[model samples]
Target chain A: MTLKLKLHTKPEVPLEADCICPDRMQSLNMTEIGDLVTYHGNRQVPLKNFFECSGEFDGEIDIEGDLVNVKHIGSTMSFGKITVSGNVGVHIGAAMSGGEIIVEGDASDWVGPEMYGGRITIKGNAGHMVGSGYRGSTVGMQGGEIIVHGNVKNETGHVMRRGLIVVAGNSGDFTGVNMLAGTIIVLGEMGIRTGAGMRRGSIICQTKSELLPTFTRSCDYLPLFLRHYFKHLESLGLIISDSLINSPFERWCGDSIELNRGEILLYAGK
Target chain B: MKIKSTTIVDTFAEAFNMYVSRVIITADSKEWAIAAAQSITGFATSVIGCKCEAGIETIIDPNDSPDLRPGVSVLIFAMDAESLGKRLIERIGQCVMTCPTTACYNGLAGGSPVIVGGKLRYFGDGHQISKVIDGLKLWRIPVMDGEFLVDDRFNIQEAVGGGNLLILGKDQKVTLKAASAATKAMGKLTDIILPFPNGVVRSGSKVGSKYKKMIASTNDAYCPTLRGVVEKSELDDGINSVLEIVVDGLTLKAVENAMRVGLMAAIKPGIKKISAGNYGGGLGQHHIHLLKLGF
Candidate 1:
């Protein structure tokens, strides 16, 4: 069962989905007319004010049409699958532990911030802080996997302790600023100051670009461990093709000033 | 009752309780997923010799997998949770981490299996990174191959093991063939999964050994020569061969379904009556009544 919520032509005003019920998502059976939360104006409003609610109690929900003002599609949703057919606002799946979020279109900032588990896939592009630490803290994301198909802004994986963040398009400055742990793989060119203060993690930049002066080059040898990792990246639809997954990587271990356990590994063509 | 001209046994197939967990490994392609599974499940034939029994449960499509890649689900069973955890770490470290484009995940969502990934993360040597998406915690251990992704925790469940029905045939070939056919049919089951090499075992052991050092030994009652003098003999003349199939299931009802289908498949051409090896009713609480099932 699925709940289809269509937010058509809503301008300004952020329609936060903090009150949207996820437990009843799958129970909705989805066959009947489901509930939706659309907004108009520049003020804050509850979710129940917009769309009419109706449906069975199945564990699934879908958001159709344009949702430029809709924020937090599946915030803190533990179970159930959520699909968005069009573009969305900020905080797509903040703190989501279980369930899946599929966005056929692009998304705004913080795609999957602090998610413990679950998955979020964006077909188009994503904005800044896609999977970064909230407000003042580091330790950005603890768990979960985020796959962004388009370009992203800077500070992508700032202090993420765990989880996987894959960006298919180019990235902005500070690719993985102050990253404590986790993996951030950028398929396209990376902006300046990549992996600046990374302590214990990996940042794989597929494109050949300049790195922050702080990052130190360890060696040119291919890491034996990456053969298995690259292949996994392909399966997730996050990285290079499977046939060329096992290519050699240019290994650089830096952000040496910090915990120094982190590494920025780029695929070095053999 | 007869199936393919073979007599149906009047006895039930007995089973014992064991710990089970499912492991899902995903990689760049179906080939790498299968490769990792084969490596991890290799040399793990049984609890008696290998300390555990494991096999590939099913292949997952990209859409269904966590990473949307080619992946395979494997079921691993052992005598207890400790062993299960140890084997998982050992196998994933050596096999999955070595296989190109492979990432390991806990197939079991909730329950018991001691956390497999949270423990193995130390192997990352401080390079290990964890991710919490949707509530599931995953570990990313940076390996030379790139990175090995795995689920943080694996649910452990109590499962029935050693559920078997011996195939008594005129020759070894016929015995193996009949047993293979039965196992092949049962292997496709969802409730019970066969964790063995090709789903058949030639050596079926018994409880307690004649020697003082051994805890359990071979079944002498089924031995053709010992058939007469054996106190609880279940074999007769012309019964030259015997083979056992072990099934692991989440529920007793699941085991029963497997046995019903297995027994029916076992008794085929060149086969005799089917019988289960049990240490009496005292050993197990869940029992399958052969008569009730057949009727």
Candidate 2:
């Protein structure tokens, strides 16, 4: 019996419903789950005030509605799965350690910020900071994967220390900025200042992009490790061209102002 | 049991418990993959002298390989897990890593983890980089061609080794022909390998020797040249030449299957008898009886 939550009344303001997570609702009854506290804007309110909750929790939660005002849904969740039917607000799956979240529609800013482990897949476009750390945090997305099928706004994977972030569409500026370690692959065009202050990590781009001066062009070679990643992404329903997998990439070692150990691989087509 | 002119001797093959590791070596082309595979499996015929027994299991298709490249699967067997791990690092680093356009990966999904690429990464001298995909770590060491990518750890599991089948024929020509046919049939199976030169061994040995320093000597009972001198000769009147096929596999069932398949394929007109080598069932853990193979 999956836990079902359908938004019956659109909140006038953003609702903080972190209690919708599987870890918190797995042991609660329907009435107890409905009575869970959720903050409507700055005021406290029961979850039953805005959303109708039914079904028993069985390691899976299916949420239906526009949920554009729902924030922190599945935050810090360590297990189970959450499937969203419509657009979701900010901070979905933030700091989640395990399980999975699949958003069928567009997502707001800060998707899976500082996530320790788990997977977050967005079917549509995403707002700014797809997998970035919070303010003053040194690391973002320590582990896990964030796959966005559509375009994403700026500061993707900011200060990311570990994990994989794959954007199938275009990406905004400062992609993988200040990244200490991790892998961020953008299959489409990337905006300026990629890997700006990254100390050690890999940022792969399928198309040509103007890079910052801190990065240095190393050599042109086929990276064998990317084939494994491409195969993994292909298994996730992404169409990876044969040419892209077989082509050589221009290896650029960058962030000379920092450790100068990070690398950016830009595709050099056959 | 008689299959045409060949008689299946009522004996068992003694196989010992050993540790095995499967390595997947992929390269730019099938030729280079086979080249690396051949190089790594060299000088590894038997554990008695080589410290390990290894053979190429199969050639993997590009689509089925770990990196979507042409690959060759090779299996190595050692007396223990620690020695198997050490042999993996030594052989992969020296042979596969040194080969052109080759990358090595652990073929087994689960076993006792042994660090191979983790120790081989030092050859890069601080230039090596590590990548983790799907929870499996791989090390990429900078090479003159491009990079040598290898798995961080290879898994070793308990296996069966030293399974043998002895073929007696009218002459050396017919004996070699039957042994070749048997190896060709057994080669199609998975999880097993014939670990001898062209899958046949002529110098079968006994447990002891006349010399004090030697641990093993020739099996005089099966030697046709010594049949008249030795009172306990296993050869018949017409049997003039004999050959042995050694099988090492990841499982006892795999060894039995290969032996069964080889026994069926080796039944020819010139073949006299098909028997198995054993030490009166005193050594080894698994005893594969020829009559109980469900022929």
Candidate 3:
């Protein structure tokens, strides 16, 4: 009973297809769903213009084809699951409170921005601002989890107050800039100024990086609490080595410009 | 009924409703974990005097432990949830936290939550950090060795306690051997603990004493020395010695299961009879009948 959507015609501009969410399609028939309104770059159009919709919604939606021009696929969805078969556009799962969205390919910027709950997993590389707040917003991604398997651009979790963001590959500069409280774990290399201006939060890196001068080295020890997070990430299909789980981490208390409560744990190795 | 040469007395063990909390202590080595477990469970034999009854439930393998360290599980029982919670705080704070290379965690999944690590974090003098992972909150208190990680709260649940078995034998050595055998078998079971020394109690007691201040006194009926003086001695002439095993468990069924296992293992040639302690079924909430044990 999954609702299947395949792109029949590529859109000339980014299409706002927030109606593709499971919450909105659960009660709609094929014809009614096809008639759903979408905006193709400020032009109002029926969803059937560029995509062929089939099947009934049963709390799950399987969407296929390159969704690079499709934005807002599961916006504000409280429950249910959405699986994108290929590359997805920006604003996917934006502000979603519950449920899960899985992207098989790369994702655009602003993945799960300001999300309260739910999970958004990007199997490939992601654009900038992976789980960040929008411009002029006070908080971002209060809860939920965003896991990216590949590399990510700068400002991965900007101003994020809560929730978990795991980047399995390399990340650009300002990884958790202005973060208030949350956990951002970068398994690969990270760029400069990690956790800059963060009031309270945790940024963990597997590989060493040049930390900002605002952070002060505290001590080197094995934090048993990280074992739980490592086990959880391993369950989510991330490859965590046994040596990494047992390694000692150098604790750095940072963001002295703000609350000075944020911490960055750099692996000290066995 | 006779399993071998021993007779299963037609009596029941009176068990009362109590509160229990399971605490898992993990450490860098099994020795340290057992050290903490032994320290916390010390002086906790009976609620009558000790205010709680506790024992080591099992030694958990590193692979099965929460933090992948060598662990020992201990269960503590008190008269009520509030008292049990207080005992948990006192024992864990003084014993487990003081032990080197030890971290404690709540073993039970569902129960009324009692704050333990939340209170212990103050030992860090405002430097303690809290981390919430997968909805489970943990406190990281800075210590001289490194950091002491503990769960924020431990769960306490309603449990059963005071389950007992009286093993009568031809002599003291034979009785001790039989009781040891029974405890070894019962120790293999989960959700239950034999709280006495080496899982055998020599000085079994009655409800009250002739002294006004003493709420409990030695059970004179089964005392081999008083067999001739006492009018109604439970022990016969051949039964010169007796020992008791007290079981406390998270559930009545678990107590019954442990009792059944102990009863079967205690049936030896020197063991004359296997009896149970009860107050005519007037004090406790549950009565475990020996004859009706469908073993």
Tens digit of per-residue lDDT, candidate 3, span B240-290:
999999999999999999999998989888999999999889999999999
TM-score of chain B of each: 0.91, 0.99, 0.98
lDDT, candidate 1, A79-119, per-residue tens: 87887888988998888888888889989988888888788
- Residue A109 error, candidate 1, Å: 9.1
Off by over 4 Å in 3: B228-231
Could you tell me how far off, in angstroms, the CA of residue B51 lies in candidate 1 after the best superposition?
Answer: 3.7
DockQ of each: 0.16, 0.78, 0.61
Query: Candidate 2 residues A88-160, lDDT tens each?
Result: 9999999999999999999999999999899999999899998899989998989999999999999999999
TM-scores, all models, native as reference: 0.68, 0.97, 0.95
Flag clash pairs in model 2: none
Candidate 3 on A1-270: residue-level lDDT in tens? 888899999998999999988788878889999999999999999999988988888999999999999999899999999999999999999999999999999999989999998999999999999899999998988989999999999998999988899999999999999999889999999999899999888999999889999999999989888898998898899999998899999999989999898999999995
For candidate 3, what is the lDDT?
0.93
Please name the candidate that would achieve the greatest lDDT relative to the true structure: 2
Q: Name the 10 consecutive residues with the lowest summed lDDT in model 2 chain A.
A: A49-58
How many clashing residue pairs appear in each of the predictions shown? 62, 0, 0
Superposed model 1: Cα runs more than 4 Å off: A1-170, A182-189, A204-206, A216-251, A265-270, B25-50, B56-73, B91-103, B133-135, B142-149, B195-197, B209-212
Superior by lDDT: candidate 1 or candidate 2: 2
Model 2 Cα lDDT, one tens digit per residue, B56-104: 9999999999999999999999999999999999999999999999999
